[model samples]
Target: MVKQERAARTRQALIQAAAEVFAEEGFVTASLSTISKRAGVSNGALHFHFANKGMLADAVEAEAAKAVRLITEAARAWQGESLQAVVDATHELTRSLTHDTVVRGGFELAGDTTRRGEPSLRTQWRHWVEDSLRRADRNGALAEGVSWSDSARVIVAATVGFEVLGGDDTSWLSRQNVTRFWEVILPRLAGRQDLDRLVSSGSRPSAVVPSAERTSG
Candidate 1:
């Protein structure tokens, strides 16, 4: 039991170290020896857990995918038939990317051409947003004549833009910046009657209803 626990800790440490390295140096340039050194684990141990840099990258993508799912699940659990859940999820993601190196690296690696075969967090997120907005439209949360595709494009572009910009300047991820984004877009997306129900601050109540449904794009 002790050995298993120790192995688990070591594996987690390696994943984290790899994420840090991948975030700083693109996937093509990062080296396994550097990751092992950062992880404070022997190169042999890293090979035991992950056969190569690609496998380590796969692990990082999986961890990052888990983080996106948490934000998605939390937002989906919100009580309402509105796009508020989507807005809240974007806020949560923006905050995560700003504070969590794993999440940031996952996104960075997702864009790297060399990591093509691994799961794409960017694709998954886009699908989730598209699916959620389609549901919202069917549920009457969207404004009359406002198409879900256009709304999806706007939201995805802005949120993704923020994520990219934040990499160079963290100010892009600030609460005020994200809140202002919601404020500008919500009016165009939500019906007049539903406008009052939406919050530009992207705040959600603490309650979440777990659902087993999952989506893959």
Candidate 2:
């Protein structure tokens, strides 16, 4: 049992180290030896966990996907299928992009043209945003004549833009920036009545449970 636990820890450490290196150096230039060294583990330990750099990148992206799911799920739980949920999720997503290395690294990897894999993080986020907007449409939360597809496109583009810009300027990922974005768009996107209930600045953090605790529970 102890050996298994240690192996698990080592794997996670390697994943984290890889994320840091990938984020800073990009996938094509990042070395497995650098990742293993950053993880304070031997090259053999990294090899035992991940056969190649692609697999390590996949693990980083998978972990990031899980975090994204948790953020959207928490928002939905807090705000149901309303447009407010979409707003809240976007805020949380930006927050993660700003503060979470795994998320940032995964996104960086997704955008790395040198890497051949699909941009799983962006695709997952786009899907969730579209689905959330669709739900809001079904709930009659969207303004008249505003199609969910259009709204989804605008939101996804804006959020992804923020993520990309944030690589050099963290201000792009700030809560204030996200709030300002929602403030501008919510009025045009949400139904007249729903607009009053939506908080462009996002809901209280406590209202949405953290992904880590949610998963453990």
For candidate 2, list the clashing residue pairs, or say none: none
Per-residue CA lDDT of model 1 for 1-217, tens digit only, reads 5998889888988988998999999889999999999999999999999999988988888888887898888788763446888888888888888877788989989879877766688788889899989999999889999999999988888888998889899999987898899888899999888889888877665422121221111
Instruction: Compare the candidates by TM-score and give the number of the best one.
Output: 2
Model 2 TM-score, all chains together: 0.94
lDDT of each: 0.84, 0.88
Native-referenced Cα lDDT, model 2: 0.88
Worst 10 residues of 2 by lDDT: 208-217
Q: For residue 136, give model 1's deviation from the true position in Å.
A: 0.9
- Residue 4 alpha-carbon offset, candidate 2, angstroms: 0.5
